[model samples]
Target: MGKAAERFVVEGLVEQTPAGPRLIGSRCRGCGTTYFPQKASCPNPACTDKAPVAALLPDQGTLYSYTVQRYQPPPLFRMDGWEPYLLGLVDMGDGLQVMGMLTGVKEQEVRIGMTLQLVTEPLYCDDDGTAVLTYKFTPAGTAL
Candidate 1:
């Protein structure tokens, strides 16, 4: 068997650049608020300018919090290796906190406020041999 062709879990959610993978988001022109998964308009009630533009989120952040998933998720969610994993809420600055799977560190070793870098890994391989990729957070400096 060879390496499988890769595809993101959702299109337009992430992009590959010369630097690395970047999350596609939106920045509100009114209040300068940023959002992940990209929003079509600013949700802030105080802002008058509802226009939002596409933006790439930072690839690094601080681990604000985390939790362990001891049980397998619903059938809609698939993983190649079914095992308990850590989920983290990462603060990417500018008041943006994104939740994603934690990688490259054990649960006992994970620490709040630790630096983390954005990464993508295969969640599962489809029957057609496509590796479904999803964004994750790993300890900074960990080799990809």
Candidate 2:
């Protein structure tokens, strides 16, 4: 068989660092605000500064909030085996909060103050046999 294709769900979102998988974001030089997906320009309209530098956020964070997605998401959002999944907003310190799926535990077991760590998991396989990966937050110390 040919080599299996491995790809990120969204390019430039996750990076393999010495510490572990960290989410990539942009920090504005003007307001010092950070954003995921790496914004090109600062969101603050008051500041005219155009410099936004890349930042790797901390992998471990606390669960700020969460909800269970019961319905199937539309196309382009690949959930191979659709089911209710837990999604949460994580506080990565420094005023940086990230929204991602929560794994490694049942939906009802999730709590507001639980500690979580970043992990890259397989979302789905493409027609070309490529494994599409996405970042998720699982209970700290759980194997990815």
Which number leads on lDDT?
Answer: 1
User: Model 2: which ten-residue window has the lowest total lDDT?
Assistant: 1-10
lDDT of 2 by residue, 10-111 (tens): 789999876778999988887788888699788778778868999988889999999998888888788778788999999998887889999998987899
Clashes of each: 0, 0
lDDT of each: 0.93, 0.87
For model 2, the local distance difference test gives: 0.87
Off by over 4 Å in 2: 1-3
lDDT of 1 by residue, 1-144 (tens): 236588998899999888989999999888899999899788899999998999999999999999999999899999997999999999999999999999999999999999999998889999998989999999999936
Error of 1 at 47 (Å): 1.0
Hey, what RMSD does candidate 1 come out at?
1.8
